[model samples]
Target: MSTTYEFQAETKRMLQLMINSIYTNREIFLRELISNASDAIDKLRFAALTETNLVPEDANYEIFLVPDQKNKALTISDNGIGMTQEELIANIGTIAKSGTKEFIDKLQNHEHLNATELIGQFGVGFYSAFMVADKITLLTKKAGTDLAFKWESTGDGKYNIEPASKESCGTTITLHLKEEHTLDSNNEQNYLNQQTLQTLVKKYSDYIRFPIKMLFDIPVQESDSVETKQELKILNSMAPLWTKNKNDIKPDEYNQLYKHLFLDWQDPLDVIHTRAEGVFEYITLLYIPEHAPYDFYQKEHTTGIKLYSKNVFIMDDCRELLPEYLRFVKGIIDTPDVSLNISREILQQNQTLKKIGKNLEKTILKNLEVMLKNSRDKYLKFFKEFGKAIKHGIYADYSSHEKLRELLLFPSSRSVTEDSLITLAEYVANMKPEQDVIYYATGKDRQAIDSLPQIEVLKEKGLEILYFLDRVDEFAIDMLAEYAGKKFQSISRGQLDLSKFETEQDKASQDKLINENKDLLEAIKNALTEKVDEVRISNRLKSSPVCLISSDSGISISMEQILADVQDSKIKATKILELNPNHEIFKTLKRTFEVDAQSEQFVDYCKLLYGQATLLEGLTVENPVDFAKLIAKLMK
Candidate 1:
């Protein structure tokens, strides 16, 4: 007996919306169905661990698809754990109404719901078949059960359930392909034929563990006659390349796997295959791309490694496996120890899953260290593309700070070209015997920071200075206050206390310049007032008369600019104005200040000097018009 039942109202709304527009490409329906079939097989495999009889020893488990072009019907069958009559009602007869309602709420909330992401995240992936089919018929019989069921629906808010029979326990899904999805020369994409179906399985489900077989009629050309004969073909790769041993795998095989996973024409930069056993068993196959995707850093771009549990594809791009900073790393991870039946939420919080993530993080960093030491030419090429994002990991991953620091590539005062990068270890090794602090300067780029007044002083002292150009460089290094026992000192942020390196006579001469300029410094500080934190004689300037430096407790100039660029609501830092007492302009200013202590010329000179110093710090002169007038008056 068959009875027509009305669908839960919310299910109908979600189904309608998804069928019409949720999945951008109708062909994704095949991928979703294939994934469901694969999951069913995984569930049964896990169950048989306790019940040996659940899976017959001789029974071969797999997926089979048969397309009837003449009847415009497509059938996809899988011999796995089938659903009981009651289970069918709970799983398919009605999708969880609450899930549908939440989807609607998120839709109205204008979340970033990419159509590709929606196809499988929700429980309604089976309904995606409706995109290419007007009606669907399902036949399923639970394993070790005598009864079978047939569920039919046109997806018009009503479905029919009746007792049915199957030769074996499993599920068979028949789709009545719509007019557009049938055979036609005008239709570029049709699902009613063998060729299109084979292509889709290879494209999306090739990584599926089970052998997906398709049966179709092939034209037999004999010398005397031409006839059609049915033939079976395996449509999917039974064992994905990631499951194999890294030592046994060849370069070409790794490249082929890269193409299969990403569908990219170019090969990967390199591939790392890591398998962890013991407490947390998992396999990580990561590929370094030859080039980044176009929208890799875009706000809406999706990136993460494909996730699998017990050889079953769970989801693509599971962000929980890696920090957001390492979004560029792409590949897959398979963990049999993790449960396949758990929700993505539970998987995220699972202790075993987290342990697998930490192990992967360490392994990736270790792999990078080897590449940098042995294959710098290629590593440098890769760093040129994704080095900034890798540094972002240093600032974000609190637990893996030291490991991330090892992979950083930096430009230094001794660097000749843009690609010349040195590690902190390398920089420290090259440091002057008297130098104990890692001196660095942050700016927009190598050229901009190269011209900084502080850099000139370091150049004169024969000290190496690291150039931090990226916006995130300061934050990442700030988190790591020191590296290899040497503390980081920003040349533009704090005082240059190289007194230990200076000879006693040199120190006395430097102190003499500061004492002689003491009176002028006091007058200049009063003149500038709140515009600067303090006015002092410079020990870190040469050609430039005045230079700006941040207080030791405050932020660097580059950091301040970053906060400003981001439009942060926090208060900005005030700069310390340091005057080069040795410069001719300051010597002339001191003479003029002594002559007329209250003259407007003296005040104009102080403001003009402040404007010049602010410009050197990579900040704009607040009042350009007034500064121009002051300069014009001084020139006259």
Candidate 2:
């Protein structure tokens, strides 16, 4: 008797989407079919562990492809665990039993979905066949069972199944090619041709445990003429690189593997090969790309690690294995102990896998620390490509903050070149004996940070400062808070104590200048009441006439610029205008102020000086047009 069934409503929708919509490339159908065949073979091998009578002990298991171009059909056969009639009805006739309904719901909800991982994790890869074929026929016989079953479908939401007989305990799936999806489309016959099938197998399933075989015709020379003979040839090596011992694998082999796996044309900057034998048994091979990809900074942060269990391909984008900041790292991780029977949602919280993630993160970081100390040039090249990502780790992963901090490098106020990157340790080693705080400043360009009056004073005292031009710089520093017990202080902030660096005579001179200009300070303070929080006598300035400084609790100019484009910032800016009190411009200005405490000329000088201070801090003058007129009037 034959039984026909209607697919669940959701399953019907999924079938249509798979057949004519969701999948962008029809070529992936071959890969899906190959993966399913490998999975069945794996299940059979596992089952044979306890039930030897299920199949002969010496039985050979492999995948074979028979192409019938004249009939427009291609059959994929696997000698592995086949399904019973009841299993066929439950697995193929419904969506709920197949774990695909939930995934479809999530896709429809428009969540931040990783389509590749979802499809790989759900165990519903069988549906991909609809993308290439309008009709599909399946023949199977469960091992050690007398009955066989045949299932047929046109993928129009209905399928029929009946009991049948087969020669072996395995499964064979045949696809009736659609005209547009066939090898005959666009004047090309390679799509369903033997050569094209072999190429697809090699590209996607070359590392499956079972050999993939195809029928090949070769020319043999017996005399002066050549004759063609049919031969069965293995198309896949079925060797996974991570499964091999590191000592036996050569560097060229690794390069080739990386090229094939990553689809990257250039060789990796470096590779880290690791294996574990104790508490956790696993092997991982990691690669650092030679350069950053164009989408490295995308918020989703593409996961590059391929996770496997007992050599069964689980997921290539299981991001929980590695933190988001390490998204640039490309690698494969295989473990024999990880359980693949549970749902993907629970698999992520698996205690054993979490333990592996922590250990792997530590291992990768230690490897980087070694490269940094040993290979200066190569390390810089790596840093040039992924420095910001490393720094981002500080903010994203607190557990690895200390390690990530050591790997950070920044352009220094002491370095001769703008591109030179220095570490905090380097800054400490070269710091002045009299300096107690680590000084840093941020700006849009090298010239702007260097021109800050605050930086100039530190430069005169032979103090080193770190330049943080990258937007992430401040957040990284905030995460670290301090390095080796020294606090990171912005030089543009108010009340940076330079008194410790000055001698008794220098202190006395600054004190005398402030005391003499006390009256002039009051005049300027009254003229610019709303422009600045407070008018103060400068203690750090030497040659420059004046400069602006943020309050000890206020936002620095650099941090302000970072958030300047934001519509609203919880932190407000409060700046202090500090006069040099010793520069020649100030000396003349003091004399003019003393002569007429309320003169219009004194008020203009206060406003003009404020404009100059704002410009020096890499900020814009509030009234550029009026400020420019003030300067012109002063010139006359």
Candidate 3:
């Protein structure tokens, strides 16, 4: 006897939303149905572990699909835990218990939703079958129960459940494909053809935990007779890569598996397979690619890892497995503890997964550290591609800043001896006993920072300053305030208090020169009102006449320019001009200013000094073309 049931208001709304909207692509129906089948098999397996008699001796755990063009029916059967009459009504006939209300509400609001996005949230994936079929009929029998039941729905707010006769201890879902969806032209039949359905099954359900099989026509030759058609079987590979042992898998096998999973042609630079078995049991296969993908920096890019529960595919591109900063990593993480029907909202509350994620992040960072030590060349190559990401990590968290700082590499001034990039540890090792700080300067290139007049002062004090050419280097150093008890200092900022390296006589001579340039410095400072914060004679310059420096608390001019260019903000800080006392131009200026302190030529000389200082320090002059004319007039 068949009993028709009307859906609840929310259920009716959800059914309409799902049928008319929820799934953007109709082909996802196959994945949803196959996922339901896999879950059934998993339930059966779990039940059999405790109740042995419930499983049949010859019951092979597999899903089979039969396409009947003659009857217009596509039947998908799975030897898994089947539903009873009550379960059929509860699971299929009504969506009252399913969380589809929330899903429908979200979809109605035009929120982003995908098939996998709603999988664990609501146990109503069976409804996805309606996207492709006009009618769905489910024949099921509980494993130990003799009675069977049939649940049928037309995806129009009503369903029917009835007693049925079946000998199998599983479920069979037959989808009557709509007329437009039917593979054949015959109006009498209601199903997809064998070839079309098999292609759909393979494309969408290839990764289902349980074996998915389809019967195909193949040529067979009997003794003295040629048979044109015979039944042949195909089983999609359903064992996920993370389920395998690390030692049992080869490098090529892992690479090929990644290629198959992501359809990415480039090989991964490294693969980390780890199995954890303590408070939480999990298997993870993480991969680091040789180069970042085009969408690596995009906020919409998938997180690149699939999350699984109990060897069954749960979700693809599970963002909970990694933080946003580490989204470039690609891999699969399988944990039996995760709920099979977990929702995106539930993932946020999953403390165990959060802990697992934190541990996995630490493991990856430690592994990278090991690689950096053991394989320097390979690590350098990796840094060349992903080093900016590492720096980004340093800037992301304060707790991991020290560790990320140690992982950073920079060109050293002393590395003039070699082209090798030095780490913070190496920089600390080479630091002079009295030198209590690590100095670094950032610019467009190593040669640019090396040739800057600011470095001459640090070199005169016998300090080894690191040359930072990469844009990330400045941000990274800022995040890494200090290393190994030494503070990091930017040498282009303010006056260098080199009291540790100066003798009494050197200090006396510096004081004498400062006194002599006091009048000329004051005049120069007055000539450039808003430009120069202060004017002073430098004991640091050897070849260059002058250089520009920012305040001690301020960022360097180079860093300022970088920030300005990146953010497109107006330059807010002015620079101090420090003139060389021994240079000819400075001495001539001192003599001229001493004779006629407010003369026009003296003012022109001060402007030239300020413009030259800006030029020497890698900054643009206020007016480049006017500055050029001034230099020409001065030459004449």
Candidate 4:
């Protein structure tokens, strides 16, 4: 007797969506189906670990695909856990109970779910067959069950289940291919005939735990009879690299594995193998590449971490395995606790996956920290390649900012060595007692920051400031406000309070000199109106006559210029000009201003000071050629 079943109203809607809208790429249907077969095989394998009788000694646990051109049908069969009649209806005919209600609600509300993520999470493998087939027939007999059954569906939300006679302990899915699709004449008769499908299987499902074979039809010579057609076969390697123990893997093997996994040519700079046992059990094999991918920063770039459950490949490009900040990292994560039916959306919300992800991040940061401490030269090489990515991590998530700060490196002002980059930890270790904050100044280069009159004063005080030259340096420091209990203070921002180094009398003396040059400062500030926030006698400048500074809230002149070069906006924030009381120009300015605060020479002198400061800070003046002429006039 045939039994008729009406899909739940929600199931009907979800099925329609899956058929028409869920799958943008029809080829994924093959992947989905193959993944399901692999999962079925995995179930039997796991069960065999404890229940030997349940596993057939000669079962040969394999997935086989057979395509018939004459019949226009594709058959994918698996020697694994086949379902009973009731189980078939529950597992295949209906959606899983947990998500059926929500899936229906989403369909009713016209909400869309990513089909790849949905099928991966919901264990809806059978529905994927509809992508390439007008009809699907599933024939199966449960292990240890005598009664076999056939379930037939036209993929229009209706299916029929009836008794069948089969002497096998597995399931066979037959997809009657659409009229337009046919196997080529030159192709082999079996699964080997479809080279493209084999390549896709390798690309997406290579790591499946069970053996996948493609059956091909080829003419065979017989000794006594005429040539006859025989089945030819090929096996897809289902064991992935991450599932193996660290000791069993070689460096070259890992490289080959990563290339296959990510489809990229570059070798990785480092690989991290982590096996966590306490509270959670999982294995993670992560690779840090020597160079970033072409689309590393793009939204469309696939994050390379695959998710697996008990060595069975569940999903590739699983973002839940790592945060977007670590998107450059390529690897695999195998967890036994993760559900086989885990979907992408559910994965984002999975607490266990979140914990695994957190642990993975921790492990990577720890690995980097170790590399920096043990292999300074190697770490520097890594920093040269991935420093920007690390800086990106600092701005990516607040939770990881502190860890990223510890990983950042910069050039020190007092360090004479050009190649050495010091980390915040190193800087903090070398910091002088009574230096309450870590000082940093961002600019185009070290020489520019060194020549700035403001840095001259800091050098005079014998305080070391970090020279940030990379474009990402400023943004990183902005995100990482403090490290090791010391706040990061920008040296070129506002006025410096040197009370820790200079006595009160020295401060008072400097204040007196500033008061005396008030008129000259006012003339300079007025000449550079809106450009200079303020002009004052500089206690910091030791040799240079003047230097530029920004308001406490604004980025430094050098930083502003660097940003302007890359940023689309041509307009930049203004800067303040600070003059040295000890310099000869300030002495001349005082006398020149006393004669006539608005004299043409004094005005020219003010513009010259502002222009010189701008140049020293690595910025172009309104007229570079005019500034050169002004300098020539001044020299003459």
Candidate 5:
């Protein structure tokens, strides 16, 4: 007997929305149907373990794709568990009704069922096929049953179910595709093309446990003529390396997988394979490349981990899986705990994804910590290529500064070679008993920073100074503020309090010298009022006559330069001039001050000293030609 039924009012509304708007991409239709077929097979495998007679002991299981160009139809057939007449109406007649979900609920001991292998959580996946097809016909027979049935629907809120005949216990769905999808074209959109079917199966269902096979026409050359031969080929690999036991995987296999997946010829610097179970089960296989990609720093470069749900590829670049700081990381994350809407095109912003991201971040950081502890050389090499990106994390978020602080490395005054870098903890550990602050200097490079006059006093006192050479080094350090109870002090930006090394007599002598040369210092300050904030006697400079330093609360020279370059704005730092009191230039200024305090010669001497100070601090003079002329006049 044939029966006709009208879909529920809500089912009609949802079906229209799904067919017209829910799915954003048409290619996703094939993935949905294939996932449904895979789930059907998984259900049968679970049922056969309890009911031995449900299926033959050595039954061959697979999903097949057949395209008929003449009929303008594509058929997806699977020899798995099928539904009876009542089961068909109950599962397919209603929207959002999942047979797999009900099957899992009925099991007394859920452990007996391998739920991870089942892909269909919501029954709506079957409707996705309607996106490409105008009508669908389904023929099915339940396992261990002789009765068969056929269900037909045009997706217009009506369907027909009737008794049918079949020789095997399985389900086959044929899609009467729309004209646009079936039209012959050179593009891959043609639904009846074998190449198009193979591509879609490999992209979204390559890791399905049961083989997904398709028939292809291959040309054969006989003795006198060429003939076409039809052969069946398995499209999916059916095995994901990350799903297997990590112990069984070899090191060479990991290297090859990384190279093939990422198209990188070189072996990775390291590989991290993690499996988490219990509350939420997931597997992560990550790789740290030996070197960064050519476009790693380009603005258009995209990055994220490949996301999979139940061995089915969900998204190629799932940005939610990793933070921007870890963008250099490349890998895949497969989990069955996430919630997907009807289209399966977007992942909801749920707690499951957030927890997985947090876990992955912690795992990567822990792996780096281990590498740093056990493999110093390898860690340093990795740092050299990606250290700037790591430093960005500290500046962008204060909460991560402490976590990433220990992993930071910088070259210091005590470094024996270029590659010898010290951590903040190491610098703090080796601090002198009298040292109360962490001192650092910034310049264009190590050599420029090494020659700065402000750090001369620290070197004389046997204190180590960290060299901030990278453009972001100063900004990142400023964000850190302090480490190990020692506040960061920029050597070239503020006053150097070497009072711990000064004696009572030395203090008194410095005060007397400043008072005696008070007139000379004021004359110099008045001359360069626009260029400097103040002129003072220096206890910091040893071999140099004068240098420029920023006020304690003002921006450092390096930071000012970086901001100007990045923003293209004219922002200047508050400059303070420090004159070495014991240098010969001081004696010459004092002598001239007594002779004629307001003379042009005295003013000229002040300008010359300021120009020289600018050059010593790695800055350009306002007028190099004038500076040279003044120098020549003074020499004559």
Candidate 6:
């Protein structure tokens, strides 16, 4: 006897939504149905462990894809624990009522069932088939039961169930595909095509523990005649490399897996595998690529990690699994704890994923630290490729600065080679006995920074000066502020305290020289009134005659350069002109001012000195032609 039933009010509304708009891609319908089939098989296996009479010990468990092009029907068949009439009504007739969830709860205390890999969390997955099919027919016979049942639904807010005949225990779902015109008008997927089915199976269900099989026509060449024979081929690999123990897997296998997953030709720089249990169970197989991808810095680039649940692929680029700073990492994260909505395509906002992200960040950082402590060369290689990204993390995430600080590397004045990089800890450890601050200089590169006049005094005192070459370096360090109790100071910015290096007589001479040249300095400052904030005698410029510096409070000169490079940035750094008292040019300036304070020659001398300071600061000399003419006049 057949009985037709009307769906509950809420169920009817949800069924229509699931059929028409719940899933973004119609192709996901197959993934959902296949996941449900896998779950049914898992239930049967788990039940068989306690009840031996449910099925034979040697029963073959698999899911088959059979597509009929002429009839426009696609069938997904699985030999597992099938549902009875009551079970069918409870699981299918009701929306959001998860049979898999109920089964797991019922067997919560059963230790063997805990190991069972069930993929379905929400019963709504079964309804996703309506997206591709005009109607669905399900036939099933529960194991150890003689009676069978058939459930049919057009997804028109109702379904029918009846007792049926079957040879054995299992479940088979046949989808009557929509008409060609209907499919085209609705933009529905055509699953009757064998190639499309195979591709979808490989992409979404390749790691199912049970084999997913499909019949393929094999071409045979026999005695100058070609014929095709049908053969059942396993479509999925069935073994996820990450699911296996690390000790059991070889290094080459991990590299090959990385290459296969990321499509990178080179081996990964590092591989991290972690399994967390107890409160939340999950497994992560992460890879650090040998080099950044071409689109790594582009807005269109997606986060690298893919997310899965119970080895079933969910999303290709799960951004929530990693923070923006670690977007370059590529890997897969699989966990059953995630609360997937009805579609099972996206993650719901929850603390589980966030906690997992925090754990992953710690793991990746620990791996990097190990590489840094034990394998300096390899760590440096990674730093050269990805250090810029890690530095940005310090700027973007203040809480992570202390952890990310040890991973930072910079070139110093004492670095013997072009590639030699020292850490902030190393710089602090090697500080001069009298040094109270960490000194750094910013420029386009090491050579430019080394030539800075302000660095000469620090070098003379045997103090190391870090070279901030990257555009973001200064910004990141500015956020860093202080490291290991030492405040970061830009050598080219503000005044330098070199009193410890100066004798009383040297300080007296500096004071006397500045006192005597006060008029010359004031005259020069007045000549270029708008260009500089102040004119002062410099203790930072040891051998160089002049240089440009920024005030201690405002934006630094390096930051000004960076900001200027950005379009429509009108901000500028406050520039100060500093002159060395011991340099011979200071005497020339003093003599020129004493000879004729209002003379064009003295004004020209001031202009030349300002031009010189500007050039030394890695800035263009404004009015270059006029400055050149002045230089020529001075030569005469």
The top-ranked prediction according to lDDT is: 5
The runs of at least 3 residues in candidate 6 whose Cα sits more than 4 Å from the true structure, single-residue gaps closed, are 1-231, 342-348
- Give all TM-scores, in the order shown: 0.70, 0.70, 0.67, 0.63, 0.65, 0.66
Name the candidate that leads on TM-score.
Answer: 1
Error of 4 at 9 (Å): 48
The total number of steric clashes, by the backbone 3 Å criterion, in model 3 comes to 3
The local lDDT score (0 to 100) that residue 550 gets in candidate 3 is: 79
The per-model lDDT (C-alpha) reads 0.80, 0.79, 0.76, 0.75, 0.81, 0.80
- In candidate 6, what are the lDDT values of residues 163-242, reduced to their tens digit? 99999888999999877513432233567666677888876677667899989878999999999998998998879989
Cα RMSDs, all models: 8.1, 9.1, 11.3, 12.1, 15.4, 14.7
Give candidate 2 regions above 4 Å deviation. 1-212, 220-226, 396-398, 566-570
CA displacement after TM-score superposition, residue 163 of candidate 5 (Å) = 43
Clashing pairs in 1: none
Q: Residue 457's C-alpha lDDT in candidate 3? A: 71
Q: Which stretches of model 1 miss by more than 4 angstroms?
A: 1-205, 210-213, 218-226, 247-252, 259-265, 292-303, 315-320, 323-325, 500-503
Question: lDDT tens string, model 4, 293-312?
Answer: 54466566678787778776
Location of the lowest summed lDDT over 10 successive residues in candidate 2: 110-119
Ranking by TM-score: 1, 2, 3, 6, 5, 4
Question: Any idea what lDDT model 4 has?
Answer: 0.75
Instruction: Supply the global lDDT for candidate 5.
Output: 0.81
Instruction: Kindly report which residue pairs in candidate 5 clash with one another.
Output: none
Question: Candidates 2 and 6: which is better by TM-score?
Answer: 2
lDDT of 3 by residue, 314-403 (tens): 667677767666777888898988876566578767988889998898888888899889999878777777777787888777777855
Clashing pairs in model 6? none
Clashes of 4: 8
